[model samples]
Target: MAEARQLREYVPAEVPESAAPATIEDGDLTGGATDHTVWSCAGNLTAVRSVRARVRDFLARMGHSETVLDDAELAVSELATNALLHSRSGQSGGVMTLFIRSDGTRLRVAVADQGERAGEGGHSREDGDDFGRGKLIVDSCATRSGEYWSEATHVAWFEIEDPRPGLSLADTAL
Candidate 1:
């Protein structure tokens, strides 16, 4: 007889400290180059790749420098990966949503998942092993990043402060 193995899910360690959780409200993006777009896809293992690609393309088209574009892509990927691993969104028939907002000076990317994860034996961060713990990368590179939950979804997001607003790397003199 074949043995069935339990899936091991990974959740990232919490950020050391930040402001207390509060209401999630969208602020104004009052800048010349302002835009907001959202995308949704099946929240499975494959979402990490697709989400990263979309975010990269979206930011590229927004005329952001390569540094910001790369950092935003990495940050978004980290957030998405976390949402998938830690929430029910990673389960079958689940879905994940990506929210992006930019004001030519700063860009914010958010990933919304179904909710907290529940599995036979999925939560394991005490082993001292590392595979899915990368949320810190987001916190390190992003200018401002945090997470909040709506009634139905667990959302994590980060904001990048662009050093050169409205400038694309394509026209750089370097």
Candidate 2:
């Protein structure tokens, strides 16, 4: 068998609370535990695959179950793709940032790009296949999803609640 291709690894640095994106509330999901990772990449189509792979690796290392793992990966993929396809961040030399945080019970994924202001209308395809389907996928997979805009960046995020062991979906009101 051929050897597997290794994706470029991103080493997340400890960002100061003040430097954290305004969209992401501090100490909210991590429960005061600052376990998070950040990846910066060119705002291009290829970045979507890289971000998804990184998300999978990160969540797996965090001991997430297979179901949760798949959802998280899909959610991130959709969000990242939206940023590239619809935002200025996808322009040449533009940059997008991916942030992932976990606190044992929950995980949050946020993608920030230097793009159009939130709510100022985003990109859509000519095909009449229901615009904004990305948010739909994110909504179905994540427990919560939202978007935020600052003077310089547009940030979209999703939060997933990891199912507790020995509990079925019917047992929890997620």
Candidate 3:
């Protein structure tokens, strides 16, 4: 596991409102409850796995459905990987921040990374296949998704609403 950076003073962030059902109220997804967390994620593959496992556990403890758990894990993995592969965060001593918030009904995840490196990014292995499909997977799974930049930080975020109990995720999508 990579060493996380020392914590910084906490400042709540807001994503622009969208058509999504759940919103982060001043970054409090639990509505004064207690389901929000921030992680100082090191830009590395190990952190990717840890982030996925942590997210799965977090949502699971909140009683989210398995499908929703799977989707959230997948989406976070992609965002973290993008930070590792496409931005300066993957460079030496680089770190990214992960924000997670959820109530029983809705969950939001975002990764903030140092913006793109000068002229260095991309995989060496390519055979005409899409090298990066992070956004595509997020688009399919999230109720709303978007990316933005603040200064030199790039933030990618996604939100999902749980399928009503007794309903499948596919059912809700329809």
Candidate 4:
């Protein structure tokens, strides 16, 4: 993992009062809470490990053991990789940021990037397909499930159940 540079503080824009529940527009999806850690990452493959390391470290500070932190780090890596590869059809050169927050009961991670839109929902890869399985892995990581959403200049995030209750992040079913 490379060292992460401070690009800028993540300043969340407000969702309009009239915004619908569970849907966000023109703002950070702080994922229903503000007591989250924000990590700024450059929009390159190299940024993946740095962001993953940071998430695991934050979880450790929150009292998670190394074992649990490893699970979360794996999920963060996948999400960051997908964001860099699929979030845009061309260059993803701006930055990728990770927002991590947990409340003991669950842990949520949101990897945000400035790029072309990558829409919501999940898709499966046929046996021979060579690509497009990132979301499937992410879906399993979520304790409940995971989702994706996007807009013109930003794609916010998805959340999965943090590894707890004996549910390994990799053991999650698609």
Best by lDDT: 3
For model 1, residues 1-174, the per-residue Cα lDDT tens digits are 010011111112121133224432345445534333333334457768888888888777776788888888888888888777777667655566676767667787777666786653445568666754566788787887777655456668777888685565665655
Clashes of 1: 0
Residue 73 lDDT in model 3? 94
Candidate numbers, best lDDT first, in rank order: 3, 2, 1, 4
Pairs that collide in candidate 1 are: none
Comparing 1 and 4 by lDDT, which wins? 1
lDDT string for model 3 (8-83, tens) is 1222245545522343344546561233344544456788988788888877877778888888999999998888
C-alpha lDDT of residue 93 in model 3: 69
After superposing candidate 4 on the true structure, give the runs of residues whose Cα lies further than 4 Å from its correct spot: 1-43, 88-92, 117-129, 153-174
Candidate 3 global Cα RMSD: 5.5
TM-score-wise, the better of 1 and 2 is 1
Task: Provide C-alpha RMSD values for all models, in order.
Answer: 8.8, 7.9, 5.5, 7.9
Residue 104, candidate 3: Cα error in Å is 0.9
Report backbone clashes per prediction.
0, 0, 0, 3
List pairs with backbone clashes in candidate 4. Answer: 142-160, 142-161, 143-161
Candidate no. 1 TM-score: 0.70
What global local distance difference test value does model 1 have?
0.64
For candidate 2, what is the TM-score?
A: 0.70
Which digits, one per residue and each the tens of the lDDT, describe model 2 over residues 58-169?
8777766667788989999998888776776676555667778776678888887666734667546565656778888999999877776665666788888885623445
- Each prediction's TM-score versus the true structure: 0.70, 0.70, 0.72, 0.58
Candidate 4 C-alpha lDDT tens digits along 9-104: 322323224432453333433343334433343345777877787777666666654455676777777877876765542243345556676654
